[model samples]
Target chain A: MALRDEVQVGSKDPSGFGVHRKRFVYFALIGLFVVQSGLTYTTSTEVPDSAATLSEQARHGEALYREFNCTACHQFYGLGGYMGPDLTNVISAEGKGPAYAKVFILYGTGRMPAMGVSEEQADALVAFLGAVSATGTYPVRNMDLTVWGTYREMHTDEK
Target chain B: MKSEWTAAKGFVVAGLIALLSGALFGVIGSWQHVIPGVVDAIPFVKSRPLHVSLVIAWIFLTAVGGVYHYLPKIVGAPLHSTRLAWLHLAIFIGTGIAVVVSYFMGRFGGREYWEFPPVLGIPIVASWLLLIYNFFRTANKHKGPWPAYLWMWGTGIVFFLITYTEANLYLFPHFTGNMVRELTVQWKAYGALTGSWNLLVYGTAMVVMERSTGNTAIARSKTAFLLFGLGFTNLLFGWAHHIYPVPSALWIRVLAYGVSMTEWIILARMIRQWRGTLEEGKRGQGSMTGRFLFASEAWVFINLGLALLISIPAINLFTHGTHITVAHAMGSTIGINTTILFASVFFISSAPITKNLRVGFWLFNGSLLVFWLCLVGAGMVKGYYTVLSDLPFQSIMLRARPFIVGFAVSGVGLFIGLWMLTWAGVRTLLRTPGDPAELDIHSAFLVEGPGSPAPENGHAVRQGSTTTLQP
Candidate 1:
């Protein structure tokens, strides 16, 4: 078990990842995996009402988003291309409401290429953003971090 | 080795085709970013999936071929069922074709990277199960404790099934309810899924290293296991770094940050490892496989630095949505994974070094270096501006456009290099087995070390012959 012994060149490793220890490691990995899976499903994730159900128009916008490959440029919840701002709370963010989002969608901002959607389509895209915003607050800035790294705003329903 | 062509080499052939075709699509996709509507027939929307899926196919096909090829050799036995092996290939290829056609026809529902329809996932899942059954049945026959590579392969196989299934959790009503949860789960699954395949690809790298050098001890070394354990831990916990901006519980991001920082330990150990592998160290400069392995080492360092910095919460807030993330992804996939896989390909085929491969190697590496730097530069500019200036997306993109253009131009060179390399690899694979120039696995491996082929034309020759390994 000595660190020096474990690293010897071409050294015969009996307990160094030996088959005898395979079962133990395998179980440990699976156990860790199960707990993580549970945490991902139960503890860390939640849903608000507006997020739990999207309007019919928002579904259309979702489809259009995928069809346009908008994700290649924009992100939701900070998990996309940096080419554009995070759209997670764009519609609800102060000074930037649905009208502001609609104009950019309808007429291509020199920055974001015009998505070439009709006015109605732009409305739907904004609606989609509205639903996403309803999901939670992002860039979770002003919260004190607990020692365990849990956040204060697990509810994600802040408007 | 007479019967080897039927089961294993078929996958190699399919994989090479995938690599060549994928590289072509990747070139097209990159161009679209610079010149919008450049390729009308296949827009970026379609090309992205074609490139992503096909390149992914190359990795799986080749990596799976490696496992199939090496399992019997290492276990000192014939395959458990060659019929099942062939069936596995048959289904895989069959499904692969369907996936490609779906992309061409513009039928897509699945998320990014895996943009094919959700139903197509059934065959993929089913076929992988066959691999699991086949892999365990064959690999279990090894006489002693399984080497580090076996553990890697086994873990990769099992985890692919687990994480892949996890990726589809979006289909369930529970996960889809909240965009936050949905996005978090999506990336969590994908992050780990990426890790699963890395295990597969990295396992292939280690196999090529062990077999070529005839250094079984390296794969069985304690250090190798410790490294594998470390990587596994990261795969489990470090994934959440990908979704740092999501409003998920802070614990996920914190845990990932802590785990990801452990790459430093991996890096330090790797430096020590280079010193320990005396045979590889001495002969590596001369061998094609050795050169590729070394290239991967350099890439690991470069990308790990970027990945670690971005894992930091403050840095990530700016870099997460930018070209920097793309740079990291590209560095890992193309720089590290592709190079290692190519090493495995050339090593397995025992292809003699040739002019085409030499040109291909230099061009590939050279173009990639330019491409990688441009992306990082673009990412830095975009990240800084997007997070700071009230500049519209256009102004920021305009600033980044020069880098994007360079990236696209370099992509063409990269594709050309891949074309030449794929031709070399496939031609060598298709050559019938009885050539005197080529050494049979038994005879060729009897000499210690893959001493690098002097030419890329005929057979892989051993340079510094040391100990003999029993076939």
Candidate 2:
């Protein structure tokens, strides 16, 4: 791939302005990097006590599980939706933790379509579910359910 | 002109298909709001997919047709095979229609944008492979220094293929672990596709400008090259904002911002330099099409400003994933790509098409201006209300109904303009007598000159007679 050749290359006139501009951009980028890095580090380090016990892979998986709104249909403990099977003790039922969880997610059941969950998300979800199953604790409440109920109440009262 | 009937037929047929699909969706989308709760009905879901998919298909087909028409001229070679072009066109159009149908039939993967399930994706992939074979074979057969525009397009095609493969993740079914990473990949693929399309558009513009103006300076070529490089780098790394909440390394964010800014700078430079080299006689006087073309330069700046605004960490935190980003997308795509395409079409169809299309041109530019204003203004209000003031998104959307209506109204103008363009293209194909003198010298010079026409009275003169008054 002549990717480099695609650039409009010109002979640099030995001028300090171009060099100065480059330096300026580099410095600005570095400064932004340091600030963002600090922020990320602080955010990641301040995990809750329950989450602190979870492995990094498990934590990552939990994050995905939350992001994808997987709990919208499937019940995790008494939390989440009632549309799908309760996954509270799925790890115990399935025998293997990550491997079985990965399969279920990749090739979903009859009603549930494949969610295009990547392997990384699958593994992380497995780790998170395994951690949950092993510990028997639902770390976070499903906020969407409460939000929906609150919206319903507001509408009902208005009517 | 090498009258490649097969390629021409492919282009015309694809365009006709696109027009039909766009009109159909346009009507559906217009009525979607009229039926109140009916818009959210299950049937509407099928229609929504059809609308979005058709838009994508039409844009892609038009872009590909433009590429086929422009590439050979830029590289100084006949097309590898008109037959292959037809085959590629057939596969693309056929698969596109099938996918849209399947989407309505509920045989979709249900992913936004990548909704066409594996069955549909396979044929599209095959079509791309066929295109790649044809393009590369043609490139290999030519024995000369390839133009920077062609180089940019070639690189874009290669990356497009790679990005598509990665996005499909068919090889690694278990590759879902990192949510941030996967989202990044999706955004990267989107950016790559859009960026490559941008490069191709700009590259075509460069070729057309060069041919019309009769100037081929190494400086101009270098500028084109720089723009393409910057665009590529920007696309590869500029998707960091999409993963703002994800645990990404700091360098990725830095790279994203840096590369994105570089792209803006390079494009800005190209526009400036091009304008600096515009001469008088080369482009005759009073060219509204040229004026509109020049006005589009302002949009580049507008896009640059928006890019800078969103690049800031504080603003990005609030604006990320909001309608403001949508505004930016519309601004760039509609503002930049559509404007440039209009200019090129006008230039190409000038002599063989309608005479005195000045009214159409102005109307088109006016409608676009209104369209963009409504979208951007409404987007800002929605963003501020929802993100900063803690207003409900739906409430803000309700408040912005007028603007949305304005957008729809503007779409009418766009529709009219597109019709005019289709008419002009047909007339050109038919070799009808258009006012050759109707071509403005200023626009001609800008095309023939080393650079684009200088900003005259804060407006650029437009080239060509058949200016569609569409936004």
Candidate 3:
């Protein structure tokens, strides 16, 4: 059987129309991707020192988080489910602290099912949340929007 | 049937089984939301991964199976090592079983999406190596300038290994120490991982189109290569869109947002060619491959529209953690990928039209449309309540409950439709395949060569004479 088509139909030029121009466009797009990836590695910040230091209890709580699939409902920093509020700073928020979190974890709340977590698990979860709370806040409630669709964390004296 | 191709058929059958099982678990998981303890035997945590991993396995297994089946024909050579292909299949199936067992035992040590025990990653990676080696070895034999599909397959195969390895980077203390870096890396790997499989699946779509239409020029066309390049660029840098809310680098979000919008070019191109495609769809309606190809086109339009909208930061703020995200996922995986795979499956099997199949197809698509809309509705409600109101989580869920119930109920219809189709597919796979030469020519009415008249008889010509069918 013949490999190439018999009639040699369509455009004959190997690179299609404007071959050299297409090559330039392809390279340009690739260059943009490389630069963007580099920026992610360089500009992104890491976890703070306090939050990075995970206590044994927090470690267990972290495991428990995955084991229970808390992400199925709860989120940290607005990245998990909409079924629960962002818990990034739940432990540190005014009028809500470790005790508030522990009670919810140990027993079922209105919408959130009681994970049936034991008292020990609840303490560890609180410790985990306490550590996470030290990292950052969620919803970035104070948004000073820039033209670029990014926000600058507006200064507030409320804290 | 070629003995060498038997394992490829087996892989596809395994994928269908996985699809059915995963979807069953999905139904259970969704209903758990409607009635809190519906499946007390398998809690949401366990059910979620079972659904996620198995469906994911379906995509990989089927996509890879399509490659194995088609590679030899396209490359004009038998696979370099059939033994390695078999080993790859064996290892993947064994690993899949292991993953299910771990999920059953409630042994989850990894992150979301891949909630299996971390150790399972090792075997999974090893099996992938066999595939990578086998694919490259086989594909290298093609004796011409490579087409866009080959490039897509090569990139997808190599990158999946890279991304899969990167996904496990959390084992390193340096990565594990910083939560921000950890999450960024995780999403990065996941984004690339998804892109990799998409490349494989899209390449399969191209090949199936090329073969069905007998239009080799389409694969080699300038437009095809440009689309492949655009998709590759997005696969590389567009992943950060998923992590925009993670408080990562501002540049990551900015770059991803820009990268993602480029797909509008593809959508626009599709729009330009819509009339031609509709004409082609009508011509090919008799062929199962034709119907599926048309279905996949519709899905691409719908899913791409949703994806483009959500990639915008302002909209993502509402949709990010909601069922809208799930909608996007389901749209891509089920709506687009699954349809394309089905086309490939029926093409390989030469599945004929039956009343049952026609009914299944309509039912599957109809149920999916409702299922998809319900998810979007749920997400919109949840997003509004969570972001704007001070409503509690349960209250928001209560508002979304009707849509969630609708989604779950439609899911049953989808499963039943899938079951009938899968049963037909499995029967096709188990039966011996006929000579490709005879089978390929008979389907010529489904597509035409570039500028060539539809042959009165089914056979197409090459070198100005009737020739053996290659695809």
Candidate with the greatest DockQ versus the true structure = 3
The per-prediction tally of clashing pairs is: 11, 38, 0
Docking class of 1: acceptable
User: Across residues A1-159, which tens digit of lDDT does each residue of candidate 2 receive?
Assistant: 011112222333122225345445535644653464344333322123353355777767665664454644454432332224446446755344567768988887544456678887788888877765543322112122232111111111110
Q: Looking at model 2 chain B, which ten-residue stretch has the lowest summed lDDT? A: B462-471
Error of 3 at B242 (Å): 1.1
User: What are the per-residue Cα lDDT tens digits for candidate 1 across B208-252?
Assistant: 766565545556656667778878888887898888767666677
In candidate 3 the C-alpha lDDT for residue B167 amounts to: 89
Instruction: For candidate 1, give the DockQ.
Output: 0.23
Looking at model 2, residue B460 earns an lDDT score of: 24
DockQ for all models: 0.23, 0.05, 0.32
In terms of lDDT, which candidate is stronger, 1 or 2? 1
Model 2, span B1-471: residue lDDT tens: 244433643554465456546545654554443333344433333454565566556556655666676555444466778677888888887887788677656565534455566567788778888777877876764434455556656766666676676566522323233333433444555666676667666665555444444344321333444455456556555756544323334455555656555655744554565544243312433343454456456676677677667765455544544445655765776577666655555554453323445555556567767766776666666546644453443466677678777766876786676566555655654562321222233343444333443332112223211111110
Of the pair 1 and 2, which is ahead by TM-score?
1
lDDT of 2: 0.52
Task: Specify the poorest-scoring 10-residue window by lDDT in model 1 chain B.
Answer: B453-462
Q: What lDDT, from 0 to 1, does candidate 3 have?
A: 0.77
